[model samples]
Target: MLLAAAVCPHPPLLVPALTGAQDGPPTGPAAEAATAAADLRATCLAAVRDLLATAGPDADVVVVGTGPTPGSAAPDAVGSLSGYGADVTLGLARVTDVPPTGLPSLPLSITIGLWLLREAGYDGPARARVVTQHATPAECADLGARLAAFPALTVLLVMGDGSARRDEKAPGALDERALPFDTAAAEALADADTAALAALDPDLAHDLLATGRAPWQILAGAVEADGRPWKSELRSSDAPYGVGYLVAVWTPA
Candidate 1:
C-alpha cells in the first residue's frame, strides 16, 4: 500500500553548495536567485520530511524520477554530484569512503532525490526508479501501480520539474502554452486529481519541455491504486530562471 508522497523539482542548484548559498547572504542581482533557490530547497526538504513522518517506520522509501531511460537502483549504488560541478558526495548508500567513480553512475534525477533524502537524515532502506519522459500516461500509471505493491508500506519521493518554457529567458523560450500547462499541472498535483493527471497530454508536455509529466502521472497512479482518498498541499508553485518548478505533497486522507 502507498502511504505518503512528496513532489519536488530536480534542479542541480537545489544543492546549496552549487549556488554558493552556504557561503553567506547574497547581495544585489544574485539575491533573487539565491533566495528562490533557498526557498525551493527548504520546501523540498520539508516535503521529504513530511512524507517520511507520515509513512510508518517500516515503510519502504522509494524515489521515483524522470530520466532518459527507464531503470531502477538499490541503496547500495553510489552517486556523485561532480557533474553538477559540486564536490559533494550523495551518500544515499551511506558508504562515505567509496570513491564516487568506483561505482556506476546513478541517474541525475535519482541523484537529486538521494541528496534530499540524505539531507533529511533518512538512513533507511531506499530504492530508486526512473521513468522515461516519453512514457505515455497509461504507461506511467501502470508503473505507479506496480511501485505501490511493495510488501511493506511505501512512500515515494517524486522528483521532476514542470515546464522549462515560461518566459523569454526560459530554456525553450517563452511559449504561450507553457504557463497554462504548468498551471494545470500545479492544480492537479495540489488537488491530488488522478483523473486530471491521467489526462495530461504527452505531446503538449513535450513541446513545453515539462519533465514532470511522467513522474507526476506515476504519483497519481500510485495513489489511485491504493484506493484511498488523498489530501494534498501545493507548497510552492513558481518559475524561477524561466523554468516551472512546483513543490507538493500527497497523503492518504
Candidate 2:
C-alpha cells in the first residue's frame, strides 16, 4: 500500500541550469519569476524528502507523470534535459551501473521526477511510470490500483502541472474558467478528497489544458484501493508564469 505521496509540477525551468545564464541578477518580471520558481523548487524538494521519510529507509518508490503514452523505466533509468537546451542528466536511482536500454527518452514529467530524486539524494529503489494525458479516468484508476498493490511499502511521486491558462500572459492565454478549475483541484488535493479528484471531468480538464488531470485521478484511485485513512497538507499553490503549480503531501492518518 502507498504510505506517502507527493505532487509537483514539471516545468523545465525548475532546474537552475535551465533558467539561463546568471551573468547578472535578474530584474523586473524576470526577477519575480525567478524568485517564485526558486521557492517552488525548494518546496518541491522538501516535499519529496518528506515523502521519502514517510516511506522509511530503502522503501520502494513509484513515480507517476503525464506523457503522450504509457511507459515505464527502471530505477537506473537515465534522462537528459538536452532537449530543453541543458546538458544536465539525471537518473531515478542514486547510483546505477546499468547502461541505457536504447529506449526512448523519458517524458518531461518523469525527467523532472529523476531530477527531484537526484536532488534529494534518494538512494532507495524507485521506478518511473508515465500515463498518457488522454488516458480515461477509468484507465488512470486501474493503473493506480495496480501501483497500490505493490508488495513492499510504496511511495508515489506524482508530477504534472495544473493549468497553463490562468492569466492573460499565461502560456494558453488568460481564461476565466482556469482559476475555478485550479482552485477546485487545489482544494481536493488539500483535503485528500479522492471522490472530488476522481470526479474531475476529462472533457473539462482537456478544455482547460490541465495536464495534471489524469495523473491526479490516478492518485485518487490509489487512495481508494489502499482503503486507509489519509490526510493531506497543501504545501504550495500558485499560478507562477500563468501556469498553476501546486504541491501537496499526503500521508496515512
Candidate 3:
C-alpha cells in the first residue's frame, strides 16, 4: 500500500549546479530567478524527505515521472544532468562508485527523482517508472493500481510540471487558459482530491502544455486502489520562470 507521496517539478534548474552561477555573485533578473529557484529546490527537498520519512527504513520507494516512453529501472540505475550542461550524476544507491551496467541512462524526470532521494539521504530500495506523455488516463490508472499492490511499505516521488505556458515569458509563451488549468490542478493536489485528479482532461492538459496530468492521474489511481483516507499539504505553488511548479505531500489520515 502507498504510505506517502510527494509531487515535485523536474526543472533542471532545481540543481544548483545548473543555475549558471559564476564564481562570484549574480546580478539583475538572473539573481532574482536564481533565488526563487533555490527556494523552490529547498521546499522540494523538504517535501521529499518528509515523504520518505513516513515509511519504514527498509520500505520500498517508487519514483513516477513523465517520459518519452513507459519503462522501469532498478533503484541503482545511473543518471546524469550533463545534457543540461551540468556534470552531476546521481543514482538510487548511496555509493556513487557502483560501476555502470550498460543500462540506458534515466530520463530527466527520473534523474531529478533520484537526485531528490539522494539529497534527502534516503537509503531505502527505490525504483523508477516513467510513463509516456501520450499515455491515456486509463493506462495511467492501470499502472497506479498495479503499484498499489506492492507488499512492503511503498512511497512515491512523482515528478512533472504544470503548464509551461503561464505567461509571455513562459517556455510555451502566453496562454490565456493556462492559469485556470494550473489553478485547478493545484487545488486538486492540495486537497488530495483523487476524484478531481482522476477527472483531469488530457486533451486540455496537452493543449496547455501541462506535463503533470498523466502522472497526477496515476497518483489518483494509486490513492483509489489503496482505499485509504489521505491528507495533503500544499507546500508551494508558483510560476517561477513562467512554469507552474507545485510541491505537495500526501499521507494517510
* Alpha-carbon runs more than 4 Å astray in model 1: 91-101
Residues 119-215 of candidate 1 have per-residue lDDT tens digits of 8877665788888889999999999999877778889999988899999999999999999999999999989999998888999999999999999
lDDT of each: 0.86, 0.85, 0.86
User: How well does model 2 score by local distance difference test?
Assistant: 0.85
The TM-score measured for candidate 3 stands at 0.94
Candidate 2: tens digits of C-alpha lDDT, residues 129-228: 8888889999989998988998888899999898899988898898888999999999999999999998888888888789999989989999999999
lDDT of 3 by residue, 1-253 (tens): 7899999999998888888654456788788988898899999999998987787687788889988868787656778888888877777655545643445478898888888888888755578898988888898888999889888778999998999999999989999999999999999999999988888899989988898999999899998899989999999889978899989999988
- Backbone clashes in model 2: 1
TM-score of each candidate structure, all chains considered together: 0.94, 0.93, 0.94
lDDT: worst 10-residue window of model 1:
91-100
Candidate 1 clashes between residue pairs 3 or more apart in a chain or in different chains: none
RMSD of 3: 1.7
